[model samples]
Target: MAKLKEKKALMIIAERNFRDEELLEPKKILEDREIKVTIASTSLQNSRGMLGATVKPDLLLSSVKVQDYDVIIFVGGGGASQYWNDPLAHSIAQKAVQKDKILGAICIAPVTLANAGVLSGKKATVFSSEISKLEAKGAIYTGKPVQVEGKIITGEGPQSAEQFGEAIVKVLENLPE
Candidate 1:
């Protein structure tokens, strides 16, 4: 059998509150670039949004080890208000950064980065509602569609999801061999 082409793996983690466009749009863009995007959640089964939209997770966050992914992305939602506070999620986020993997988060999901202790002293952009909170975590807040500081990238909200996705593609494309 011919060897399958190896593709970069992107891990998108979100709770049921993940905004539809925020997560799905990025996934689509990554897929278009032939990058493997996996949707992981607190559980292995499907997770539903506040609007009752159901999304199946490719893997369970609890079972995921950050070393296996090339990038780790967190999606925002009102649901993130709760999810970000989960200890396990913070652990995974911290692990990703410690492993030097690219970390991306949109909207309120940046809260995960803040909570993970990675945003300290880094410039980041996040949902308007959480700008103050992000600042409190020692992140320099900005009002931009996307901000890429080193291996970390952050977007404001669902409105910037498409650009957020594109930013990730460019970052990945330009990575050193």
Candidate 2:
């Protein structure tokens, strides 16, 4: 708890149509716990959510340095699919794992982690529609609202955002320094 006050988290969102709750809920919970949050996107311009929320990203996704943050999260929506095959996004996910940072994805965004090859053999959950794709990537789909495997967390959808946030917080609280 003492060290969590200085924890930092990087949240990646689609430049358009990121799920509102998926991004907002977890962010609020993390902030409430004193975790610093930074927003990144493919485009730095204001990004809009599917439900009409908007965010001005603090940095370009391409400009991100994985080592700067203790946690990395991918917010999901129809637009999150844009990252599913993106090489940079995949590299970020891989680096997060290699660096021992907490990593997360909500809704369809978990597909990006799956595609990045980090989700293989990990227990995860994602938006219902992408179940087969996640399974194809060698992930064990738990069908839970939120699944936490080691330092990786996956949320089923918008409804699971709070649980997803709490899961990350719980892990951070228990993380070995």
Candidate 3:
């Protein structure tokens, strides 16, 4: 038997509105395994979810250092579009890819990654409304509830949040220890 290496995950949510389940479901899955989860957002104030789950961000997105975590996830909602073309979000996504850290997004947040140029040639999925944006970025849209391609993971929407979290944990657990 061997002790597992500690893992840390950074979850980015929208300042005003994020999908509650998308953030909570995944955060629970990761924390159950004793993995540390940090919440980040565009602002340092409390973030309100679409479903009314208010969360205080631990840090601002502009201050994130990709090297500090094993995974980086963007929680999606109607407001997730705020990061669709955001340079800071795109830069973070690119750095995560460049560093080979597990990258994940649920619902519409995948659009942020697609726009970041890291989804090119990767298999991914997103909320139906965002399919074209992913396809336009050269990502093969699989339309699955949850899709895991290499170290990148994407979920169709809130209903897929749990499976998305499971997929991320699977990837993290299987990484060379």
Candidate 4:
């Protein structure tokens, strides 16, 4: 077997409130494999999760340069809507795709990618409430527990958090060194 290259992932969470499991589960999976994970948000302060998990961001989103990581994941919650039309979030998503980096989004977080124009013609899944929004952005809605199209992965909601993380790890593991 070939040795896997060291991998790093950037996880973006809403500054105020994000879904706890959606961020934690995937982060744990990546770390378990020795993949470095950096938590980032709009601010450097502690961001609170819906279920009370407080995470201090390692970096501000504005400081992120797409070339620094192999994967970029956007964690979702009601607060994730804050990035739906955010230009910085959109720019980051666009740059991730341009760099062929793995992109992951769960729940409504996919909306941010959609608005970034990266989801067009890609098969994706999102929380039910944002299905039409995703479709409107030209994404083919799969409605699956987890959807992986190319390097982009999307999950429906909190219930699929574990599966979502596993999917990301699987994709990362398969990448060429």
Query: Which structure among the candidates has the greatest lDDT?
Result: 2
Write candidate 4's Cα lDDT for 1-177 as tens digits: 213247889999999779999999999888888888999998898899999999999999999999999899999998999999999999999999999999999999999999999999999999999999999999999999999999999999999999999999888878776
Best by TM-score: 2
Give Cα-based local distance difference scores for all models.
0.81, 0.96, 0.93, 0.93
Q: Which candidate, 1 or 2, has the higher lDDT?
A: 2
List residue ranges in candidate 3 displaced over 4 A: 1-5
* Model 4 segments more than 4 A misplaced: 1-5
TM-score per prediction, in order, is 0.91, 0.98, 0.97, 0.97
**TM-score of candidate 1 versus the correct structure, residues matched by position:** 0.91
Candidate 4: clashing pairs of residues = none
Candidate 4 or 1, higher lDDT: 4
Each prediction's RMSD over C-alphas, in Å, is 3.3, 0.8, 1.4, 1.2
Please give, for residues 81-166, the per-residue lDDT of candidate 3 as tens digits.
Answer: 99999999999999999999999999999999999999999999999988999999999999999999999999999999999999
Writing each residue's lDDT as its tens digit, candidate 1 over 40-62 gives 88776777765566788888777
Candidate 2 vs candidate 3: the lDDT winner is 2
RMSD of 3: 1.4
